[model samples]
Structures are given as structure tokens and as C-alpha cells.
Target: MSDALDQLKRHLAPIIRLQQIDGLLSWDQQTMMPPKATTARAEQMAALESLVHELFTSEKTAVLLAKCESALADAAPDSDEVRLVRVTRRDYDKETKIPATLVEELARHQALSHEVWVRARRENNFSLFAPALEKMFALTRQKAEYLGYRHHPYDALIDLYEPGMTYADVVALFDSLKPALIALVKNISEAERQFDDSCLQGDFPVEKQHAFTQEIVQALGYDLTRGRQDPAPHPFCSGFSRDDVRITTRFDPHLLVKALFASLHEAGHAMYDQGTPEAYEATPLAGGTSLGVHESQSRFWENMVGRSYAFCKWILPHLQKVFPDPFAHLNALELYQAINRVQPSFIRVEADEVTYNLHILLRFELETQLLEGTLSVMDLPDAWNAKMQEYLGITPPNDTLGCLQDIHWAGGLIGYFPTYTIGNLLSAQLREAMLHDIPNLETLIEQGEFSSILQWLRQHIHVYGRKFLPQELVILATGKPLSADPYLTYLQTKFKELYAL
Candidate 1:
């Protein structure tokens, strides 16, 4: 490497460490810090982010990048340094266009609003969180304007999580899936096979919930050596590095399926992180390529594997062991049907498969309107309730189950919701592709073996990391750019079996 390249590393190393410090602080804020620490934490994050920006955009750094880019282009594509330079260059170019004020405001709101959102969600009061959300929307509009766009403002936003993904594409995907999902829901709506989900309701106790879910996550092959699972109000996965992956979930005493499904889902994400290219650790290419790809992994495990009969058959005995009173008479078929039950629900996190994307679609629509200046923050609760009624056919009695329910906008993730469905779509596509390699996926899952899926993910997607755009990874893995066919097919097949249509 050239002297310039060495100097760049010397300057950038401290920035990378600062980023890690911010990450750890953010994780601790969510998992352990007191509520009073919100403002302090936000200031800390803003300061570190400012430092990163200054270092990244410095005159000397640009000189180093100019030098390194030339050398990196000539190096083997498989080399770690080449990939890091390429990935870092892309981030540098993109982030440099964004003003520091905008970035800091995003950080600041994410911290304070998160605390407000928690209380508002708990109290079912959208008004309490409305002002902060208003500030967030104003900042985000400035963001989309700064980012600029050719066809749609939302397209610029979409590029954040799923590069090359257009707002138009998601609309088309959601439009096509709507009829199929509606039909599936209608079919099951008339079915006589009603599951007594009441057994899953009532005071079951959180201690047992954690213990049972812990076993399920372990069986899913989460590496305790490289990762950990914790409890958070809204479950998520994050890390300082690939080897330090963390997953979080919340427990509800009255709900048996909530914590278990959450752990498996988050474990899927943890597996993806833990499986990321080891050579890329401490560099930019070390995690899933995008939120969409990350979501795909989680959805794959939660739906394709966790909700499948094969997995249920394997875990039914153990689930029964946890709460014998509620589960003793229940068989795998019953459990599978219950977990995958088609229901119109208020909360996105708790929504079943048939109606889940509708929840995301609702967010996409509302956020689109909000960003375009057509919807006001104060009016959001009404708009949210109306959409819930329109989409899911049930209105949340309060904001806690409606506008204030999700942690996304409160965390300044304005353009992130669509990826949840993108992940759902990509996960199904990846599952279809995997069946070609492991035809007996059901048998493998029944044996409590998940390495087959993880191995395929590492080979096809994880190893490349951010070296590939999200869409490029989709093409490499599924032989297509992006579509809703696989997701629709899976839902139709599984629900058709369950409802016997």
C-alpha cells in the first residue's frame, strides 16, 4: 500500500472506534440506560457523529481517498482492503452531500423522541409524541430535498435501505399482493377450523416466557460465543462488529407466541451478522448489505422456518414442556395454525402473515403523505386510525396501537418501513432459491438444524456484504432484481394448507 493509504488508515482508525463507541452507547441506551439519560445520550451521539463527519470530509482525507482509490482499483477484487476502500468511498460520497446540521438533528430527535414515544405508546396518546414527530418530518423533508431525485422524492429515500429500489416498485408489489392476500384472508375467514388461541392468552408469566423462548433461540443455532439475546420494548439486532452481534426481544406474560417468534426472528438476523465475512470485521462490508437483506434473514427464519409445520413439529414437545396446561393437548398442527393465523390486528409487530404487509403499506402511504407535506403530524392519529380500518378492518382504540406504536419514525427512520416488506419479499425469494439446493429443508428444520440455510446465506449474500448493492445481492441470490411472486406464493401455499382451500 502507498504511504497515503497508510496515512488514511491512521486517520480513519479513530473514527471507526468512535463509531463503535456510538453504537455501544446506542445499544446500552436501549437495553440498559435509565430514561433520564435520553438527552445526554443524544448529545453524545451528535458529538461523535460530528467528529466522524469532520474526519471523513477533511481535505487530507480526500487526498488519501484519491490516492487509495487508484491503488484499490488495480488490486484483486477479492482483497479486503479493496472492498473496504470501495465501500467506504461510496459511504463517504453519499454522506458528505448531507449537511452536518441535518445529520445532528436526525440524531437528536432519534434520542429524545424515542423516550417520548415510549411513554406515548404506553399511554396510547399520540398527542404527547406529535410535536417531536413534527420536528422529525420537517427535517426529513429537507433531507429528501438535499438528496434530490429524478422521478420521485420517495425513490431517493428508498435508496437508503434498498439501493435501486423505487417507490413505484413497492407500490406495484403491494398492489399485486393485495388481491392474493385478500383472497387468502377471505378463504380462511370462512373456515370452520377455529383455533382456541385463548389458551395462548391470560397470565402465563414472564419468567417461563423467557426460559421457553431462550431454548427456542438456542435450538435455532444462535452462537452464544459471538452473540447475545436481550429484552427490549421493541426487538432489534445491532452490533459494534460482526462478532459482537446482539439481539433483543420483549416478553409479555399473557402472550406465549410473542416472545418466542421474536427471538427466532431476531436470531435469524443474529445468524446473518455472525455469519458475515470474518475478513470484513472492523470494516464497512461486515454486515448484511441493507435493511432489506437483514429483514429477509429474520423473516426467513420467523416465517419460512419458524412458522412452518416442520419446525413446529420439532418444538411442540418442548413448548408443551414450558406451559403444559396450555399446550399439553395442543399438537404441532394446532400450534402452527395458531402462530400463522390470519388476523386483522392493530399492532404491526403482532400482525399475522396475511395482514402484515398491509401494516407496512400503511406506514409507507402515511409517511409518503407526511413527507410530501400533505399530512400534518397532529392529524396523523386520525389518518393512522383510518388506514388501520381501511387495511386491517380493525381500528386501534388508541394511539398506542396506532400511530405511536412503532419505534421507527421516533428513531428518525423515515424511509425504513418499506424494507420490512422488502425483507419479507426477498426472504421468500431466497427460500425458493434455497429449496433447489436443500430440497429437504423441512426435514433439516425438523432435526433442529439451521446451518443449511445459514450456509447458503453466507455463500450467496453475506460474504459479499455491502460490496454488492441490495438489489445486486437480490439478483445474485434469487436470479431476479425484486418481486412479490415468491412472497405471494408462499403465503398462498401455507395458508391454503392451513385453511384447506
Candidate 2:
């Protein structure tokens, strides 16, 4: 039995490494790849993806998995060996359902499509990206059909990122969130007092922003010796291994919050990667349990910690030091109000916390419609604009700000948007639980002390890696199942106090 478990780990290691290499290539393509190399990169990615699919879904892998499962039949279900075999079985079943040819084509098209989306966004031309979007939805539909879902085609695709989650589950979650979010937006809009966030905008140079962001992330316990940050078209975190995590952010010279919060967001993700148990490396237990859980960590740091009044107090002096003109005159409370001001915005990533979930709701609805054939790619921009107006009381004037703002569709991430909201909800839940444990969490943040906070997360959440499912992990960490009530209460209390509603 021991030999069989060892053999299973050995069999899975190379496949896991190959997948990491694939992620590395993707990270490079987004950050450092030249414009003209898109075609070559597409081919390279396709070949690598095809080989990985073939190897991971091979007969030998199946034999080893079965052997390990049988050998561990009497072992405790929560033991690492049993969990490993269980996770591998789940992944193997899902991967083997799709043909390698489909995987290759999706990879090739994803690279090309991302380039098209980039150009279209820069040019503000949705027509240029429409064909690619159409093809992507088509391929995704085919992939979903191959995987076979009972209720909706999207269920299969979403499950690839969030195991055990279904389309119905997402719909129910969003349905519960919509009314509260809408009411919050309405109340804030009609509030007697409004905040002036001019303090967050000014002549912030790119170099200074980068340096400041590096300083901030490092202070938050993102280890520089094991990780680094770079600039990308969109901000993202890529972790190939515990020691090789990388983060990228897009800078706005006029807006300091854009880069600072983006850096915090990605660093949250990198810290999670860095904190995973070393024994899980290069195995199925490595990395995050799910994208939803992963998003919670990012949102935890980005909003729960980075956007707090306590964080403002700690960061103001540093901001004043780096970009002296605007922040030098700002007080901590004023800085907090500036950074946390509620506003509806065109860019989803730049949306205020009060309205961020509405953005996700829009994408969730559109993705569902696109999959169900109720929405066409050609009409997507109009649909997006309508939803923006309906949800946030504003409409985008162009496709770039409307449909082309996100890189998810071009990258074949149709079912990925909802995870952002899932992360947001869970972040609040985790914060609630953490505050109960460490009563001085806010004081620690104000003092720029994060090791205790990080250690708390490491002890509860990060240490498990993929050993537990997201639902299981959430309950274990928080002592309650995930509910929108905590998140809703959080937003209401914070915003009502800020706006004096």
C-alpha cells in the first residue's frame, strides 16, 4: 500500500511540473512576450497543452490512481494519501472526458484570441474582437457538452475551476445578493454627504508607484526572495511553485489607488501560494483548493486589510514619502474616506467595493446567456451597457469600457467572473472569524504588523492547500457555512457609517 501511494505521487509529479511550465509560458505571454510572437506562442502553447492532456489522461495514470485508491481504501478519508488519490481521481475523470484535440485547439485559440482582445481594447473596436469571442463561446460550448452537465452547459465549465459548484448554485447566490447591493448603491447615491477622493489622484509617476507597491507588498509579508512583481496588460498573480510565485500589475500614473490596491490583491494571492505546506509541492495537493477560495485570499488583503482605516493610517506616511504632492496633506481618516469612496465605474477592476458584486452579476448573467444562446457575441456590448445602467445607473459609452474591458473571454475564462464575488463574500466571512480570534487585528494593521495575521491564515486556511474542498475549508476555518449575510452586513455597516445614511 505504501509503495502504491509512493508510485502514485511519482507518476503525478512530471505532469504537475508540465502544467506549471504551461502557466509560466502564459505568464510570459501576458507580461513579456512581443506583439509579433502571438502566432508562434499559440502553436507552442497548443503543442504543450496537447502533450500534457495526453500524459495526464493516459492509461498508465489511470492504473496508478486505481492502485493507490484500492491500497488506501481502509485509510482515514482525511489523510493526505486518501485526499491525494481522491483529488487526482476527480481531475483525471474530468480531463479524460475531453479529447486532446479540443484541448489543443482551445489553447491555440486562447493565445490568438487574447492578442485580438488586447488590440481591440487598445483600439476601442469591438467588431475586431467579435469573431474571436464568437469562436471562443463555440469552443467552450463544445467542451461543456463533452463534459456533460445535467442542468446547464455552463455547469461543466464552472466546475473545472470550482469543484462541486453548479450553475444553479451561482444563480441562487447572485439572486440573494442583487437586491441588497442595489439598495446599497441607491442609498449611497442619495446620501446627503459625499466624499472627495481628489487626494487619491495626482502626478503619481510610474517608477515611484512601482517602488511604493513593492515596499507595501513586502511589508505585508510577501517574501521578495521567493517572489517578484512585474507590469502586465492586466494585473495577475502566477505561482509556478512556492518559491517561484510572480505577480504583475498595471499602473495608472494619475491614480495611485489603482496600482496600490492591485499590488495588494495580487500579493494576497502570492502569499497564499508561498504559505502552502511544502509537502504538497508538485502534487495534486499543491496550489489553491479552488479559484473561489483563492479569490478570497486576494480580496482579504486587497479590501479587508488594504482598504481599511487601519491600513490607511499605516500607509499614509509611506504614501506621503513616495508621492509627496497629494498625500502629504492627507490625514489618515481623510485618506480612508478617499480610498473607500463609493462610486459606480466603467472598469470592473476599478469598481468600488459597494458596487463590485454588481459587475460580477452582470458578467454572470451574460456568460449564462452566451452559453444558453440567448445572447449573441455581436450584441454583447449592448447587453453589457444595458446591465451597467440597470445595475449601477450608468452606461458605458464604448465597447472598450463595456465588453472589452476584461481579458477573461479572450482567454477562454467564461465561468471565471463569479469567483471574484465568491472571493469577496468569503473574505468578509474570514475577516469576521479572524476578528473574533485576534481582537487586535485592526491595531496590528495600523501598526503595520502582518505576521500574526498571516500566521492566523496560515494556521487555518493556507496550510491545507488542496487537501479540502472550498466549502469544507470555509466551514472549518470560519466555523460556519458560507452565507451572504456576513458580507452584506459588512458592506451595509461600513457604507452607512461612511455616507451617514
Q: How far is each candidate from the true structure, as Cα RMSD in Å?
A: 1.9, 0.8
Candidate 2 error regions (>4 Å): none
lDDT for each residue of candidate 1 in 319-404, tens digit (9 for 90 to 100)? 77778877898878778777877878887887888899889989999999998889988989899999888877788887877788
Tens-place lDDT per residue, model 2, 74-134, is 9999999899899999999999999999999999999999999999999999999999999
TM-score of 2: 0.99
After the best TM-score superposition of candidate 1, give how far the Cα of residue 428 lies from its true spot, in angstroms: 1.1
Give all TM-scores, in the order shown. Answer: 0.95, 0.99
Candidate 1 Cα outliers beyond 4 Å, as residue runs: 1-10, 74-82
Model 2 error, position 88 (Å): 0.2
Which ten-residue region of model 1 has the weakest summed lDDT?
Answer: 194-203
